[model samples]
Target: MQAQRQLLFGMYMDAMRMDEVIEHCRTALITRRPILLGVLNAAKVVELRRNAALRESLMECDLLLADGQSIVWASKLLGRPLPERVAGIDIFSRLLLLAHKEGRSVAFLGAKPDVLAEMLHVVARRFPGLKIAYSHHGYYEAAEAGQIAAGIRESGADMLFLGMTSPKKEIFLGSYGASLGVPVMHGVGGSFDIMAGLTKRAPIAWQKCGMEWAYRLLQEPRRLWWRYLKTNTSFAQLTAREMFHPDHPFLAGANHRVTSGSPMLPDAQLRSIADD
Candidate 1:
């Protein structure tokens, strides 16, 4: 069964609940068909306006989910209500459990070496039955991406999770995801840190109220304050424009180059942008 997609903020977001997403992933794994999952938050929605490469990479995704409650609220305000915020961390955890229960092997890429090790340790204790096919730190040089992708392909993993930040994760997947032979690929930014206990997710109250960004700002005010301010303000403005001027050209979706069983971008270009 195909989930309904709602076009909001110039992108088509799958209006799927958590259970549906998990079932879709299970089917993808069973069928051995690739499902490149992407997610959008308020910051990403704002970034899409200026980052052509990011926008293109995201458009290539087979499923795009609202990762921020603000995005869900925006959808409701725009008359296209999404089911809920499918936070990347939540989905990552669910997929791990699913893989464990199904006796499927999974691969993990990204995060610092130490953090990756800690996360793997935690995963082993939490899901003892899950098989880890391959694991790699996110600090490899740009030229090493091919070797990394090859390693994942050879490991015979059913699902691959990337804990790197965007648009690096997006670019890497855009360049090499088709060749990796992984049925399910998810870019789960910062989830490694959370799993390793290096960072804490906001309380459920903060998440429900769409104040998770504020909680993050409180966690590291010096580094995140400016970023949140700029992106949040831009997102709010963009949301207002979409709500008030539904026919505006600026709100129109771009000519997206969706994935067609091929790499989204050339290796050279994707690597160059990823290095930037």
Candidate 2:
């Protein structure tokens, strides 16, 4: 079957659908093809894709998602507004729902033992029909990774969720997913704890306002301070530069012109959503 395509900002793609993501995995298993799910938070990881090597790898992927509202807005400016933001957590839930409906199998590898256990229970209870092929608690070394990879291969899991930290999860997926025969893999950083009720998501209002990062910093100041400081500072610089300059580097010739929004993008959108 030919994959359906959408014209996105300077790119062509299969129109991203939550259900179709899971369906693609099923199809890939039957057809023995490789597919990638590249999730992007435009403000956070957009710079990562600027590297020539990284950009090529991401574009080579079968799918990419505007996982952040900032990315959606950027896409609009780039002339390819994403149909919607595909939040990883939400997509994770949707994938489980589909797996339950179809009786497909899954395995989770990574996150602390307690987090993974509780998350597995929560997922199983939420989707009674879904099968958990297996789970291995996180905290493995490079040498031990082989064992976990072997376990996933042996379990016959159709989908795998790796809760390891950034680059690590991405590296693992890029390196081992095809060889392990898991057609669908998602890097869900720290999500197991949130999904398991061991940790809480920011309130919806805060998230909508893009202040969830603030709520998180309030909760884990010591660990997140420097990271937040760096990213948020870079975020502010990017926003300011883009807002003031008609010819900002980020806004070059991609999509809809973005000179009309408020100085702060999220605040601008929050105000608009509130008015609605």
Candidate 3:
């Protein structure tokens, strides 16, 4: 689990492997702290630069799962290969199955105004007895953050899935978790759109081939082309640099890397950065 938390610009190495994720799902069923699955992609790491506080906030989560194939490839190149890519959609469905079996309830907190309502019906029909406590579209103005927090508190939801993008979800979780007492807070980018019948996941073959990003690009060419243009390129370049430059601080002194043998980075350097 610790092999992944390098400081590459506040990017998190995902903690749970596929088997571990399955185990955690089962554990959450019994323990009542619904698991918070964070899907980290290259774009999200880049987006972190805009909000320093949000990076720190995500660093405090119970778990972060690698949702992007690039991340898995990076870990492999770094000589710390992860077990598998745990996509957000896959984890969501896995959790739902666990919830169905355990009779646990869940709440949806982000999506288009009517998307959550539609999702509730779809999910309820698909998984009998799955309870949905409350849901809201994630279009609140800045002033309404507090009100949204209050709404979460009032809902008594066990697992709150913030279907917003990075920093937004992290900000919401870090701000609201203290008062709301929800056990899990999942940051599911675009999952609501998929759940609300607005988009489709790539085929299992495509996902397994690690071409899911390509499929998405084909689907939403105009909206996502620019985003992919920057993030994908930056990630590829940065990852390559890390592969060649072992001395880089981002890879050397990351928080999540498990330091088992010779240290990946000098302990003093790591301690200093961590102190700051």
Candidate 4:
């Protein structure tokens, strides 16, 4: 379970490669231990500044993957470069294929009703023999979170993929993910929409050029244009500031001190997840 990690802009991001992440989940499934997974991107990183709960939830996760190209670039500039970007969508797709090959059951939580149905249908079509333990749309009341969690637990799923938004998704998982009893749980934001064919992913060229955000901005300018503009700028400024002032409190290596045999540091942030 030991792996390299870097504290970037007050967030702990896993430096594990995609294969390492996949192997970790596979191990979690076999060992029956819950590994809450989170994906860090520019927008999510910006939100972490204002949302301590979100930050704590992410810190608690057993694995944190860099989902945005911007995050990968920032990690490099900060002098603790991640091996590569482990985009959430790519992980989701890869896990589905893995699940099919291994005969592991999965549960899906979140997305609109229509989108959820279409996504399930598409998953069925594409990944023949894949087991869908359970599915629910994201329209439920907050009060129903416990019931939803219970349903997922009862399904005896090996993996659970949540397609909800930021703080809500993180909070829900932090609140009930452990009790849900799923070994591999991940918050895959908006991936269900793309899986259902209701939304288009960026073209290969845009993704390769790290202009996927620009492509996304072009796709839904009214909804996403300003948001990305603000987040990208803020991330750039924050990274620059951190680069100059490397002694910012998050950079202090108190918890990162050498342990008995493992390189992994115990996280104080995850312990504070329920405080919010």
Top lDDT hit: 1
Give a tens-digit lDDT track for model 3, residues 91-112.
7777777777867667677766
lDDT, ranked from best to worst: 1, 4, 3, 2
How far residue 176's Cα lies from its native spot in candidate 1, in Å, is 0.9
lDDT of 4 by residue, 41-148 (tens): 876665665555676678778888888888889889889899888888888998999899999999999889999999999999999889999999988999999899
- Higher-ranked by TM-score: 2 or 3: 3
Question: What TM-score does candidate 1 get on C-alpha atoms?
Answer: 0.89
Clashing pairs in 2: 77-255, 77-256, 78-254, 78-255, 79-255
lDDT of every model, 2 decimals: 0.82, 0.61, 0.64, 0.79
Please estimate how well model 3 matches the true structure, expressed as its whole-model Cα lDDT: 0.64
Question: Per-residue lDDT tens digits of candidate 2, residues 1-276?
Answer: 654544432234454656667677668656756566766553324233233333343444567665565655555564544566666676677777767777778889878888888888888788876889979887778888878888999998877887765445656676676778776777665677778997677898976765666777788788666655655455445545444442322222234333333222332221111100
Model 3, backbone clash pairs (residues 3+ apart or across chains), number? 5
**Clash totals for all candidate models:** 0, 5, 5, 0
RMSD of each: 6.4, 8.1, 8.3, 7.6
What's the lDDT for residue 204 in model 3? 84
TM-score of each: 0.89, 0.72, 0.81, 0.88
| Runs of candidate 1 exceeding 4 Å displacement | 247-276
Candidate 1 RMSD computed on C-alpha atoms after optimal superposition onto the true structure: 6.4
